[model samples]
Target chain A: MNSMTSAVLDEGKVVLETRQLTKSFGGLVAVNSANYRFIERQAHAIIGPNGAGKSTFVNLLTGHFPPSSGEILFKGQRITDFPAHKVSRLGVGRSYQKTNVFPVFTCFENCRLAAQAQLPTSMRFLRPAAMYKEVNERADWALDLCGLKSRGDRVAGSMSYGEQRQLEIGMVLATGPEILVLDEPLAGMGKEESERMVGLLKDLARRFTLILIEHDMDAVFSIAEVLTVMVNGTVLESGPVETIRASKAVQDAYLGDGAEAY
Target chain B: MSRLPRSLSILLSVAIILLGAYPLFGDVLFPNKHAFLMQKLTGIMIMAVMAMSLDLLVGVAGLVSMGHAAFFGLGGYMLAMLSPEYSAANLWVVLPAALVVVAIASAMVGYLSIRTSGIYFIMVTLAFGQMGFYFFNDSKLAGGSDGAYIMVKPAVEILGVSLLNLGDKRTLYYVGLGALVGVYLLLRVVLASPFGRVVSAIGVNENRVRGLGFDPVAYKLLAFTIGGTIAGLAGFLAAIQYGFVNPATLSWHHSGEALVMVILGGMGTLFGPAIGAFVFELAKMGFESVTEHWLLPMGAMIIGIVLLLPKGVGGLLLQLFSGRSKMEGGQ
Candidate 1:
């Protein structure tokens, strides 16, 4: 497993790093020369105010957007030029801020599509899709992990929003990623659904390396081993959760209602 | 979207049976008009095959191709060119040649068209199809606007012994039926395959599919090529049936009509488009027999169908057959 060679978050080896990475749309700089490092096995949370470069930063790492300039390295291998599919194949699975599950397909099929991507090529034509025993097992594993095992036969579109969010995470899990990038696992969720997702995240933290972008302070504080705070397309503060919470500069940056939440 | 109801499935099976056994009772059923009716039925079946192939792109892959007839016409042209002036060409030799030529043409067109999506895709494919049309229409070498003809129809022959003669209307009718059935089964199997699941998945959500780590373009191209190859098969059969290959076959009008058939019968279901071809042609003939101006009535009927049955006749049948008519029909 590449996981064996990669850092254990405690072992102090960087799994993903961005160096002077930048993205600009016309004159507006979305992500401006931001440098960030994510260690393996750590649950890292990125928190920022609205319009902060958090989403753009994640897009760069996942290869959804090729940076205007700079570089990204995964397990010390240069991956800045890779496209989204290639980046994903390199064990960097990402869940969208918006729910992106296949709507008309059943929940099982949604997860199956993700699991099927692990196959060397999905160009296989002669054999029936159902005959892939290992892929089916992987899908079941993901579904059970995401707590949607019983809802396997249900169509994704017909499901509640909370359930669709769970399926979103479920799809990323089916990809068997070494490091997971979740844009917002708790956005627009009710208290109970949020708690369930928080519990799921806590459980996942023990196994896979995670990079999360979430506005929910309580969940962030409880789950993250380290936190990176961004403001206006740049990193403001980043360190252990306790250290960032105590920093005067970090406090000043969050002046007003944002400071009270912190 | 799921399984058809038992009764409706049985009804489809009976239709197949009737189509297969029609020749046996043709003389008794139509008497003096038997030969004419058989030829007409054969024509419907060939169109059905073309419609079924187009459904692969429109229904399954969610790629609306406006140049589908370019591939269809190429297949017919292949048969015409391959056929000897004084003797019938061997079916084995001519079929593969036509299929290969059309396959290459479609791959090139698909490769180019895939670069553009949405309305641009439609325009690009149409442009390519029109190029084919004008090339055949303006060039006198291939018979110009008058089109080319196969003087001797293709027959399955091996070692100088003729096994099946497509020149005979009865033989051609059964052959066309065979092609329709073969294409149906092939598509059904393909849809159930892993490749098919990805293509259909592309239709629903391409971005999500890309996020899942599959190259959407490669999948789309493969689906397009397969559809084109099958459409060519229909065109090849059309050439043999009519003993002619014309520029109109490659026209955008032909592609638009085939697309209409796909939407009319039901875009997603294979059986729907084939049934669409059958119904569309019969309706045309019925209208033609009644009035000199058939296009006006046919146009009105198509408009009525699109307005009333948004999912097409195949979709309506799917709802009824799957027993979800009441719950889903209002939608």
Candidate 2:
């Protein structure tokens, strides 16, 4: 009750807070003693070099797998032990690093399946799925939000790579999540696709909290309000985007001379 | 949403009509040995129903269940056990009872088996079938290895006014036809439902389903349960046709044969397996007449079909008639 009240009223408070979160695979400590408090409705970005465990950290935060030790609190509720679906039920939507959508289904159908997950159950057996106007509307809303409104009838597998990537984000949007964790949403897109995605991300930041893992420094600087740089599974630097960008330590250890490209 | 080309759709309609009218016109169609052909067609229809049921798991859900015949056997055994020793049992009563029992049993089996996938899933289901076989084979209460009998068969009666009688071979044949059509329609309805859409999506890619927050396990378990209950219906009809139930009914071989029928006909297209079942049974009969060692030639025939037609017989028909690529089964 207390957490719910706080979550509703306090806009400045953290929406997703993880403490001492650590995960190890055999001898490799992929995420080591990491802590992050994501402010409600803020677009935060996590950036790192390859092998810094950005993807693994996203995996833990989304409950794709359980952490070896730690607690993940959402809206002040301890959800460390929750499974992936349960976490989704609590309104944490995550898009994969790779494009993931129901390939055989139409783009609208793909989002509808995600929207249906918000219901108590899909045990809905007899009446055809098309009759559910609300689900269809939600699916439409997702497609519209992701700029794929015209492609609702096209089979997802038959779609272009950029459109499928948009559909992936659209599916997450349909789930009606409070937080969006996107892993490399622009991994393989050309400049045109990337610009459109950045526009979509900016539009999304107004309504929901976003945690993005991006390698494109141009997109990172334009969209993210704050930046956290990770190195060897530990937070090496974090602050306002410009502050991190200008930091001498950040530049020496990770960003180095390459950040000049930005 | 999945529309087969116009040519294939017409063919499907014509096939259903022919099946529905076969019994009525059997005398004129196969005048030389109408009775013999009727019996064979009836058997094929029963096997087709069973094959269609397993397709829910194999084709739509992309789950390979090797113990599907266990439900088939259980359906037959349930009928035998429910019927009284002397007079015919109430069809309305025993049919529902057998279905309910089979539903619960399959739910349990699905719960255990759905946890595994690929080869592990196949082996687990096969093991479950073997367990059922051994249990019924050794138990004296079930008449041991010799099996049990219905004796009088079931009849549909409303306040003693008889609607149908199973003892009449003609009546039984019609009932089997109804069962075949009813099961087919029910599966079609389910495949279009929200629950079913998620299931097919899981078959295509479970990782994406999970990303969308749909529990793959729940959908799969329900599908397995439904498939099992429908297979039970087929088994009940088979038992009534033979008036007997035996351990062999639930054997692994039956599961393998049903799987072959599903794959040979076409996996996803529901009509394919039904066609496959008719073709398989008829071909087996044809081979047996030519030689006693029909197994050797039968093996060669299946391999040749599978190799030549990668999508099975249904794929060949679709390509020849519609000139379309692989298409989904439902509307």
Candidate 3:
């Protein structure tokens, strides 16, 4: 995994690059100046303790939180000040830390809405929504990919928590994004569910650029080829998974929280 | 997929056919009854259109407005101002003129109002409605407090063919009915469209919709404009029905009552508002004939209905029929 990651990075395969990204709320600087480059079609896991700015970092990249001063380039094109919708239309999709979905709508409807978002005729007033065959097909493909094909008719709110998380990611997939930002996709899941999500993430990383923020260390280590450890509003270190695991600073700041007991 | 449920589609079709055929035997059906039945039905149809128009904003787009009556009054005022007695016009001339005028006014209002959400949106809409109300109430150009009269009902002759004689009461009644059905179909098609999906999606989770590359404001503004235009049509019918336009048409109370009807019928359900209008208007007439203080019983009945059916009569009907129809599960 490390050799593969370095090879991809060396080949100039960077898809999303941020330079000196900074965000502040009054006296509290949620994210300090951070420079990073994410390789194309690679799973990059961001791990940190509470208030370590991992979420804020993801937010900055995805346009949920505007950086105080920074430049974000997607595929070498400047997207520093683009709104979330504009960024999304440029094929960058993201899921929230909290499962955000149209709860009253069915799984299929939720996916279909996402799929129809970027279509030219999405605003057509007289055409039936079901008549959009491409959108429907994309939604179906996303559902199948997320293992929600059988549960497509179920109302989103009624679905189990783990399934809701899957649906959240599935919605982003339905949008046909080239890059995906999964903000704590595996949060609050049971052992079996987290493992299942980890497997799904591994499979997705092959076809899509994945930037994940997760607290599950085991899952992170299992699937993430590259690791970026954030601590106290700054990036402590970023490198291959093994280098992060071997770093003394990373061990002391995050991995070493209860290392002695283990 | 079917646009409506099997039961609902059948019910809707039967209702439209029955209402369409009502004018044919209207005299024989109620020979001994009051001759004002056709006139009353026309009034009810106008209110139904208004109610449904508001539903597009409140139920589908999640925009609760308190000044929809402004558009209603705008249409009426246009008709009164453009009447033969006032400015010499025909139906073909006034209808589009009124719609265009209302569309511009609604666009201006919606552009400002759509920026606000929830209670602020309601207040903004109410303020706009009052602005229109006071303008007509204080202006002497349209008769002010005494209101203005549209003496000529505006003839409808298309290219020398007398397709509709608006001067006749039966003709006006049929036209009103046709307008009601036409507006209903128009809204139905829109609600089923991709635009409607986005509008409903906005109503659910606007942030999520935004994340999916959809701008909720544009869809919402479009909905507001369409809704306002349809309400303007209702206002035009009302003006034709009574040959009068007044400040009361644009009153905040009128907007409030329309909101009440939308809620009472079911906000998101397309057919609910019309059902709500029917029940509300008929009940008002029934109660008014029996007692002077009709509001007491009317209030109690509405409260009872609200408590009993939280989703409204249309929702209740949907729930009852949806159990047997698997096709309506997602919708």
Candidate 4:
């Protein structure tokens, strides 16, 4: 598909733009100066080897940790210094590499909380939250999207690894972000589960903007319209799948070193 | 239409009604010997309010404060200092003034302490409580370590006729009971509110709360301040009931005692701390009457309870009720 067609398919419009965003831990730089843009309504993938500072980039973009120096714009507004939640509300939602969820809460309650975040005020005391129709409806919608409708009452911690990963994504989606950042949505899933997840993710891209971080080459190639390859916290290459696949440098730096092992 | 279980609700309402009418029945039930029991019950009710306030932060918000008693004691001392004569003549002026002072003090403490989390939060609160304790203990102007005595009880006047005499044991019992019920209802309202859900969510996962477009720190600070204010209210009533105030009221041990009460009854349940406070105080009183080594038995009981009942008394009761429901469903 052409870039415009891909953009139209994904409802987001240049939701996140970063210029020379950098973060350092003491003398060692975790994420060097890098410029990137997540276009409106597209499944953009960022693939890199270990220690490529991909997580750091996600952290800086999401306001998990402040950047040393750079500019980040969300929906054309500067949000470099906004706290994590503020960035999220600005239409940038992210899922963690490590599953972060409310373990004790049921799957339904977890999603309900995410839905509740968008409410005008979470400070309304004197009314039962469960009785709120909007919250329940939205939470159910999220559960349906994540394919966890039947497991709504199950405690989050009790879900299988694959289901937990799907729930994590669902939790992020529940926040209704313009740009949904999935930090390895298929990290530890088996073959069938991974294929199922890719199909689900592809379906999601039609309705939402997605910035996917993945090490799974086949999945990335099949789903991503634009692929950005990173090595040591800097972009090695960026282009269509055919262009990236043809690049010898990307192969040598990332794939060539035991493509079979990965 | 089917409703939620009625038995627990019925039991709660019956308990509240019986407690409300305790003053009227005390004379008939116990004859000339009801005064002491009534006074002790009132004291337990006051402590319950204080425990409930602490639970808002510790149990619901996942903030373990070791110095909640500082706010409680500060409330009492503020009232005593404001009413130097403790005369019933100007209770209208004294009570509100005391509450305002305590609220401000607790708010300041919460604001400063909330910046730190985990052990740091606990330590900072403890430090503040100690500072408050020493400040009162060393200051002779507010009667110092010797403490101050209430020469007169504050009376509630309505159209030239007082609804109840503060000096009367029955009247004080009703007042204490009223505070307990009012605080319980208010807390229940808060728990059911969106803000309370956010606070509970923060306890469950701070990062997720933030990811949902909330500043967790801001919510936590708000919860801490509100909890402190409620504790201060309890302190205000405690001083009036006792007719005395002392630096010991703000001591670290008092704060520790409150924590124990929250844990003993159950965390996160509204009435858990109240139940804990009542049982704890009664056990302490009864144990002490039997032996000088009461603390040994108390310590053993706490350890046993912690090990045997991880969810506290409230959770166990919930389990039992839910279990019974399931069995009935099978039949």
Better of 2 and 3 by DockQ: 3
How high is each candidate's TM-score?
A: 0.96, 0.95, 0.94, 0.92
lDDT of 2 at B321: 68
Every candidate's DockQ is 0.78, 0.74, 0.78, 0.67
lDDT of 3 at A139: 96
Per-residue error (Å), model 4, residue B191: 1.3
| Each candidate's clash count | 1, 1, 0, 9
- What TM-score does candidate 1 get on C-alpha atoms? 0.96
Docking class of 4: medium
Model 3, runs deviating above 4 Å: A1-11, A257-262, B24-29, B86-88, B324-331
Instruction: Report lDDT (Cα) of residue A66, candidate 4.
Output: 97
Query: First chain TM-score in every candidate?
Result: 0.94, 0.95, 0.94, 0.92
Q: Tell me how far the alpha carbon of residue A60 in candidate 2 is from the true structure, in angstroms, after superposition.
A: 1.3
B235-311, model 3: which lDDT tens digit per residue? 98899889898999999999988988998999888788998998898899999999999999999989998999899
**Candidate 2: where is the Cα deviation over 4 Å?**
A1-11, A258-262, B1-7, B317-331
TM-score winner: 1
After TM-score superposition, what is the CA distance of residue A20 in candidate 4 from its true location, in Å?
A: 0.9
